[model samples]
Target chain A: MTFRRDRVAALAVAALTAGLLAGCSDDEPDATPTGDGPSASATGTPSPSETAPVDRSREVVDGAAPLEEIGTTTGASGSSFRGATFTFYRLDASPTSTLLVWTMTGGGGSNPQDANYLSWELYPRMVVDDTEYRVLTYSRQGEDDTEVPGAVSNPVLRLTDGTESSPQSALFPPLPDDVDEVELKSPWFDNLTLPVSRPG
Target chain B: MRTAAATLAALALTATPTVAGATEAPPLPTVEDVPVLAQTWVGNVNDDRLAVLSVHGLRRIDGGTVLYYSMGTPQDALGDRATFSAYGNGNTYVFPQGTNTLCAAAAVDAEQGLAYGALAASTPTGCLSTGIVDFATTAEDPERAPVAHVVLAEVPDDVDVVDVFVASQLVQGVPVEDGPLEPTVEEAAPAVGTGWPSVDAAEVAEADDSRSVFDLQSRVKDLSEDVTTTQDGEQQELDLDASVLFATDEARLTSRARSVIADAAEQIEAAGTSGTITVTGHTDSNASDSYNLDLSQRRARAVGRALEQRLPDGITVRTEGKGEAEPIADNGTAEGRALNRRVTITLPS
Candidate 1:
């Protein structure tokens, strides 16, 4: 797999270099096309207005989609916490990762609660074969090459009429490939079994 | 042109995804016309190498908030290298849930007379991930404009917007769009601190055997370079350069060192009252251990006496010296040696 990817990358580079050489040979006086060597005019202060047009298209490539949506739970899978209703909407799985999506509906009665009022530490987890896999947290490399974890993405969800719902998702380590079923657990919801779907 | 060539060379390594007939890549969501919540420019506006960072998406996940922004140079041929570097090296300050005040991150060579002193100080935690959307050259389009680098940061929940301090410029009030933004990676873990429940590393290792486990440590520094303070929630250690405090190996405080010690006294007083301040002096591995220890002890005593006189009543000041035994930086280099030659005043929170 790695060899194939490398070959594709090499071919792409060759093609791009050839195209660049062909394009620059037409009008650029300073364009010194030496196969894959540096462009002579790269350091020249070319005005922004006189620069080339940008290609915004994202080309599709192969072997990129390593994960697929393999299974999901049926029916209204949700749990309530405080004054909010959290509904599990979707789940996408791969061999090494899982993406779980849900929605949080505000339950504004006399007392109202939104996303801001909730604690971010309350993460959902999945239990496969009695083994629990917690929702993964995001981390980045810090000073002195330390891995600093515990960064979260919390979008502001304001509840005006108590019916407003906001989409939420969490990524987790994957379940076993052959596992047919697993149980989902969250702070706001009870443990519920979800059947794994293997689509051809 | 060397930079452009280098960028293309680097891009070529990852450009395989652009090749056709490879396994089908996941379809990226169509670029939406998301409203820019906040925007700021890194580096001097007049500088040709300037980059613009604008917030476009913000969403809440189970345990944190994710912010998406576009960081890129506006002009063609000016690669996103500087912009990406600035963002990578920058720090994100978030107003954690229910708090209107921003916690200040310690900065190196921070501008004098900034409002950071007014805000409470805390180590900010967030993970920054960048994706190169487009890399264009002047040859591609006479305009040579490149696509902006897409940056996503996961911060603590309740962070509606964030103040990014990158390349010595603080861009504040960058509002987050309350919408969905796809993450570049599938699996991400929360930062170590910020009150999140701890995960079982053994269990996590079993699930994802390939995950790299890291030692988590939170060290927040003060804004000054000469006189810096590092805190880890429990204790705050203020390190004052011995060179600034004394002349060479001398134990006596210089006239300029008097003011520096005075400022540290004020900080110590402001931090709290009645806490025991342990003043420990360190030295580089230049001289013998005994000689260095004696010098460090004298230096610690001098700073301790100065602090004792300035601090309010009921506060105790103790002094000691480790003398090249506990060097924070490498002593082999001159810069590291200078860092090692310092007096540290530790105060418990």
Candidate 2:
């Protein structure tokens, strides 16, 4: 009986040793790289590309330059609102319609809804067939339509001050009759371009 | 015991047909279908300020009809063993207790809608203290904006789970003096030195900043006639860019513009001659002229109040507004409309 019990104890001790060795082996750190370099996780970073701009300038398309050449201004004008400049162009017809295309700079970053206000303000104007009209302005994918999902860029506006009487109603004029070729002001107006078609 | 046994046998017999019917049709997986291989618990809460309830679980298998796991933890102990499955565009989780499958589907739909609607996250895991999470699209790309929020709470035995709540909306705004208003535009007049020239009461007609006053006479140094010939004894153009704010319309300044105002304050002080400055507010054509005018004045006063709190000694500020009648930009485009919205500061001009 004593011999049998001693043999049983020896077997149990051997089994315990084997189990310990197996557990330790399982815990050894993995040698192979676990993460997929770029392919591993599904999460992707924000795309790094320039956002597309709304074409509002006039020099590059069909038809002659919309207006006669005007002079240019540079340098700080010393007025309260300085660093301002203007270009002049005359329409063949008596321009009843006028559009103001201007740009503003120096604001920091912008909110998701109003990205156009982020850096610069582009205000443009045009006149066709004597009736003034204002261009509708909006950011890419913003409230005023032009909804591009992930775009982050300022908008260029083509305004026509259509007559509706009061300041409140000035923007409610009928759309412009027809848009002639767009004109461009150098430097500032470099990339700000817009395709002018017959107003809808 | 015999009656109990009989009832059990009857129940099993009744359940067998439904189980068999569910298995009769072979399930197929399509591109739109997600194949889940594990059990999941779906969790949701009807009210924000309460503990989220973990619904029952579902057994998901590739090419297999989903099944609700009848066996689960108790309602009081849902956290002990929870499971989750991925389907549709997001995750569906399982609770300790048996949950209604329909409820789980509804919860998932709600989560995804809320996540994408306001541009939030679709997943709940790895939440920030703010409870927001980020999710990836099917193309393995992250979403445009952070989509969802998850919060964890511990309730004592006596507390009701329904009482715990969480906030789901996030708003960003900066305090501004008044709502947007149209600016007035008038011809520019000659000025003395760098300051505006003394004006004749008869000629003063305040205009918004809408039409920029461009005069050839002003640009040309004495080339043509005098910039302002004494036409009828006296003349002054107020050319005031004034607007109003109402108590009801607490126009919040855009986050960016608020910083611009702060910078303006600094620049004004740097220009010297500081004692008291004036801030004016304005309103658009949205209210009665008289009421709008009053509101504009009040809003200007409010701007003064805000400036007083932020500005230092040496400058005392005054506030006022002119509503409706005066406008600069045509209140049409968002840009022009925003341009109309403003708080103007005059430093001894």
Candidate 3:
């Protein structure tokens, strides 16, 4: 089994898009991600103080999908789960089931509750071979009732497929013997490929 | 193993076990003799590589480890600022930034002018801030950022260092690192986590470090390099070059000197109360020792008396005349000499 993760920024896909736009010049304003998220704004950029030059190799020129580098877009799975960047990790296959992991992040949130609200909205889909498998799963990140000033979680969303299960469907088996990898898809993120290995 | 498991089984059968009773026992999250390290690099606004907001988690398991990070900051880069980030059990979490009036911790996190502070929503740090950036972590989204600081992850078996990360920048707990690993029977057996360390001592050291960060950025600079304040613990060190505070050898307060001193007084008051204020005057080693000492003492007394009038009650303002004894800068060059000839104020800790 072969699985190649897209080593994108550990930030939210939305922030990557915004960072893509701002990548043109390291001259980004001190504008924060918390306000509204990834602005394609002429907003003042951060001080080019110690910033390295934009590594164009990381840039997705010609309008292709974003790469692991900044300015690259996550691959699409023909669903709402397209155009976001993430690090595809984990493919745990058991005698009875499999688990897939992917995490998405964003720039700073405008408010403290934004990341929690975002986490609640994130979920993943399981695709085995060419068929889409249905299994209920939860986002890896969450929030609690908090009241502190100036807290920033580069807003992260962790994706996993470990806890999901399929009913008695032979065609859509949870851990088919011949299947090599399963694509983890989300409406809010891109499709990440992961190879499956049975638990020891 | 059977004894403990039997005890737990009995307890669970007798009454509802607390949620923590069912921790991922050792076999499931196997502990390793060798710890894991998560490398991180925080960059200046212009040259950062990763968009890591803060550390979410860091731990060592039988297989691979968990390394999590908070994803974003309000600004572009994280350089030389207080950061609200935490790491535990191989996970790293970045908290929210900015002064949150609506937050219960806002007053505390933004009071006392602590240089840098981070509170994970999961862990409540009884800290207050009054500096450039201040924040606490919420378990979930809408991360707020007030200051900036960064740390690359490393070794988790040393839970002390990990705890330091938590006390300095973490709120509570940490993120979990979940990656592709071939699950082994080795991890399924119950195991206890390593003995943790005292976070209280780490908190004190972390507080001092936070104060220094806050102090460097807290000064009022009418002229870029002339007047500045740095803090260590409860002591606020105000440095004003004698040239800027006086005319050559004159000790009478200059207009600029008075302004800077007045601002320092305000900041001193804001930090805390009922502390001693030490006013020490210094001069370049150009004159006789006796002459310089007398002059320095007179200058120190002058500043002390002036502060005595401005400062509120409870703060005991005193004078120390260290003439040519302590040279912060070189006395050879004109610039260094100017720096050496200055009035120093040390606010009580």
Candidate 4:
């Protein structure tokens, strides 16, 4: 009986050791290249070639520049209620409507509902030639009678290390031809003067 | 065999990282740290729950003023759950300059999650009927006192301060700040939720087609067990309980009904101009519609005649019956059915 128990215990210990070694072996490939290991050169040579084909599936699609591009005008920033800063990135204008692309940053540690307040509740108006224009509603592409009014898209852009940013775009009524500058009236802030760069 | 077992156990222990000494998390900040323009404490006597409501500020958003307020519990308070229902729905109102009192279409809290807003898009009227803000203690951090943001939309512009009526107590001269309250470190990443539908411009345009913004008043008061009153700027409706006015299945007035009608007539005489007063009778979802209609019509006429006799000439009284229709409360409960069966006297503007 003593002999049989000793054999069983040895087998159990051997199995536990093997399991631990297997776990370590599974993580070796990832950690090897980062550490000063002798196998680093052997494994590093083939990694780029192996990953090249797999990376194609995740590459940006052809003709993707237009989809990511914003308006023609840029370089304007202003502050609004609750210490939120707005950096206008792009401004695209057509005959029927004007699109303003901007990023909202700051306002750290606020309630998430504050994002909703800034997006849907607050309407930013633009004044051109002393005529104030409101946000124009637009129907979703290919969906009739489903109008989405102009507002920020996301509810919250967490302020982490004061670097978090929320990208937003709002549509407004059309601007007249050769309009060089306009005043923006956001919530609590009466005037944010921005120069418009007309499309060539 | 014992040596082999001991070696395996030591190997297993070495594989896992050692835990550092356990340290307690820092405590959450108390509600006193928040900057508030106006605040009031409300207690629920039945549940022993106390809540603090503070108005932070008002900002002009999208041609309407957005009123921002915070609802929270003081540190060490007995009750952690704070909601708009605690102050009673329709009890809160904002009076802007020149515009009539604006009742909140809906009150939303961040803790309910974003599904509430997506759901509100489908049923606009149901969302408009009840405005609720519910805040409960989170399981992950029970020590953190629950605080929720409450917003009321469509307040008229240029009003610096307004009177807020909550829990039957009037708070006058509450200052309205020009901008929103400064963001606090403790409030970072409050849970995301759907906004009130009325704040959405598209939804507002759609709802406006069916119901006017001026018609969204819900100030109601119950004077006694048998009498209730609803008032807006333009109209006033007084409801008299049918059980107090008539016997079951009968249109004849009870002996005590005369004093009630007399009091209503006196109020009408004082408040009404030389205009037509409408006395409408409603019934709960009981008995046949035709039978209920006949009974209601008789009851309205009886009350109308009683009012006409008490008032001097010049006020015109019109009587109508809307049986089993236009129920103000749900008919799923006994109390709701009792409330539905009533005669309403609407004084003209």
Candidate 5:
């Protein structure tokens, strides 16, 4: 079935309406996906560097929904299950102090009719600026218990501000602190171009 | 007598069953062949294409003359799923839910890297479960990747039944030291100490700068146009020329950029570790430092975007704009300015 394109466009338009946002030019000595590919001549046995890219593509395809634009205003303020509701929040941070804060919320029982399956992910992408940086991602659903998988929902991207820097974690790797903007996509939302600042 | 013969043929057709229990004794390998399952790709947990059912890893049916197996990689999972095509007795085969992790682990075999194993969630039986092992039938199409099929003498009870869930890039796993990235290499080089005839170990050691003999030859070819070695231990350099493209007013890649980018991607794939490409952009002295900086950024981004879109994701494409800082030739001459306003791409060591 088709989703509303306007909703998706509106979010990005709203973000642009709010403010400006922005990685690295390739000529830099350190910026490349290295220490990644596997050694080629070892043996016939498969290696990780040889297999990482293939696996990465499979993950994107498996989680990816059909590329159709859609509107998503109602879920931004509605309830997820009859009890817990979803909300959208924002933050601005600096490059140090490490006091980075991020917020994620949604409403109306994430019941998309088109979903054949469900999943939560901590996907990461870099804006490619030259600034050195790191980012961390996790769920706070059940913070009291360390062993349990948190109940928090999916799709999180946190940027470092001038004072508070991003942290390194399994999900988000090192990225350029000079990222102008961040865009994240999942079955969870129509568009993920949300700016950290509100519109004037 | 003819009627009796016809009766005997009918009996032969109706004699056996098409499926068997997991505990049942496996059929004799020499007399009748069985199917083997192979992994083609591994992906995330919520993949639907991965969910679409196919032939399970193990197959055993009493008196059945057929066997089936399948395998593939992540790039093949364009739509989120891969395949396990098999032939012969296409009937029910038991799939151990827990053993699926074994397939996941296989994709992330330590030699490959953690990224492969990292994608898969923890399986119930723990890591290193004996994955599916049986050589039943080969896949139908050559395009359908070869399944890692190993014919087993007997079907084991605790067989791993993982399907190829995700797919990553299917880059040829040839070593960078093997040959030139611009010209693909497929010759099976003898590994060190194999001592095979005509495969000299001393030849590999002679090229000290390169990681292997294969790499030395590739680097020598890349550095010189018509590279040749002599007993004098001295080498001569030849003229090496390559081409780049630019727009009329700007340094941005034009429509014709695809061919150049395609050629670069081929080179990157062939280069192996050298696939990591660093693209540096420059501009003429016509614009302000600030404007030229921005312009060069745009041009480099354009190249980076084009390379990422055209080449396999494994090839790292990095872009930087030197503005008017570094000039190949003097910006005074139109010919020199044209050379200055260019993007130089370098493959990593």
Candidate 6:
């Protein structure tokens, strides 16, 4: 009776080993996260929606996570050198416009970085009805338009939604009706593709 | 003290007007109508006092009459954060680098009252120590002039400024002992030497130093008779809001933009085609650096192309797009944003 029970346990162990082997794939991202904070789970198929910028006018999914993994492919990620994860977080959106936000999380270095230390020239991009529109950033609220913070971070961007003397009234291009995709991009950070129009 | 003889000579000339307004007018020393140079002050303010390092020129404004100053500091000044404040000053004023009430000590060459504006630091609250910014009025008619200027109307006609000292500390002035009314053009020049009482070397070196801003009326005492004398060249920049020129993000010139280009083309032609005509397109800080740089360049090229068609054969037209790098106004406010989105067609004189 003891020998039979031992054989049965051995069989069970063999089955578990096969299952684990079947799940193993060469494409799997590494388990260890790189960089400062908000470590990425690093364990899922790369979402297709992250390939392109978000089209907020397209029916957005309800109760979706605000964050999306952005460019490692766009050549704008720290992940190329260090295994850092770059993400875009959508905070809000208007009918045709979306407020796109982003952060670079998990890089190699453990050195302390001031929130204001990081600086980049960032702005919004959108395509509507086959015509592309670029929004001119009014300011990081510069001294005048020319002088911006030499050092800064916490990059926030949005469409110049014209509302009573806001920069949108004059500087920003009007949002198009038949919008395709809205995006925020910077050379320093990766291109942020929002989670809009989820594929079936 | 250096201007004593010049002041008396001017007084004698104005007080005793001969039939001939002669002397062919000392030839109005070439005002240059343009800011010859600008300097920024490099010092920090501490314990309610700003240390006076060497002063640097901030640039010139108001028909070359008003000079602006920037005090340089490794540490930022209270009002220094407000960079837009410079464009907002309507009646030619100075932008004290980063200062507290330290520059508020006003002084006038009792001989010529306008001298007060040069050395003193006047705040938006009229240098009154009030938390509020913005003076009650434009002409320091009530508040004396702030920092230096090449040409300022603040100098009174009949008066001659012999000396300058802190206003409250000293009670005496160069007394006007019943002089003439309509001072000659030579007499009109206000004698307010660049007043830096602390450093005797700077005081002695005032003649050659660019930091030493002479009164504007005095600077223009001799014109070579060939200066076009227009305010267009008075400031280094001539910027036009982009909204008035192009469609949202499109670099293609709108009809309205074309019209503006035509008008500007005429101005360029009139200004003389001796130097290269640089057409630069600039955008506000709304987009990424790469994107902004590309768009602005494209827009500038478009304008340059159009101007090329209209320009005279020999005028060299160069177009460059300075993304969000070159801003002339504050981007914090709407009005400032509008000012930032611009296309400037610069014709070198």
TM-scores of the first chain across all predictions? 0.47, 0.20, 0.34, 0.48, 0.25, 0.33
Model 3, B1-349: lDDT tens digits are 1221122223235543223112111112111321112212121111122222233234233222222222222222223322222211111222222221111111011112222223322112222121112222233422222222121112223232221122112122232232211111111110111111111222223332221122111122234435555332234577666677667667787877677677667767887756787889988778877888888888888778777777888898889898876654334434346656878888666
lDDT of 1 at B316: 94
Over B1-349, each residue of candidate 5 has an lDDT whose tens digit, in order, gives 1121122233235434312111111121110111112211121112122211111122211111011122332232223222221110010111111222222211111111111121111322221121222111123321222222111112122322211121211111111122111111111111111111111122222312111000000011122211111110111111111124555446556666666666555655665633566676667677788787777777777777886786666677788877776543335434335545666566654
lDDT values of the candidates? 0.40, 0.24, 0.34, 0.40, 0.26, 0.31
- The candidate with the higher lDDT, 2 or 3, is 3
For residue B117, model 2's alpha carbon misses the true position, in angstroms, by 57
Report model 6's TM-score to 2 decimal places: 0.31
By TM-score, the candidates rank as: 4, 1, 6, 3, 2, 5
Interface RMSD of each: 22.7, 36.7, 28.2, 29.8, 26.5, 36.3
**True-vs-predicted CA distance for residue A171, candidate 2, Å:** 23
The best candidate in terms of TM-score? 4
RMSD to truth, every model: 24.7, 33.5, 26.9, 27.9, 26.3, 31.4
Candidate scoring better on lDDT of 2 and 6? 6
Rank the candidate models, highest lDDT first. 4, 1, 3, 6, 5, 2
Regions of candidate 3 where Cα sits further than 4 Å from its true position: A1-200, B1-227, B285-291, B330-335
Candidate 5 fnat reads 0.01
Reference-based TM-score, model 1: 0.37
lDDT of 4 by residue, A1-200 (tens): 00111322332343344223322322111111122212112111232223321211011111011112211222123322345444553344444345554543445332222223112324456766535554432111111332212121222223322332323434444566777566776542335666554333
Please compute the TM-score of chain B alone for each predicted structure, in the order given: 0.48, 0.28, 0.39, 0.54, 0.30, 0.43
Predicted chain B of candidate 2, TM-score versus the true chain B: 0.28
Per-residue accuracy of model 2 over B1-349 as CA lDDT, tens digit each: 1121122233234332322111111111111111111111111111001111111112111111111111122222223211111111111111101111111111011101111011111212111111111111112211111111111211112211110011110111101111111010111111001111111111112211111111110000111211111111011111122222223466443344344455555556666736767776655556577886776676677556755776777788877786654433334333334434555566663
Residue B214 of model 6: what lDDT? 26
Q: Lowest lDDT 10-mer window, candidate 5 chain B?
A: B211-220
Q: After superposition, how far is residue B99 of candidate 6 from its true place, in Å?
A: 3.9
* Model 3 residue A79 CA deviation in Å: 59
TM-score of chain A of 5: 0.25
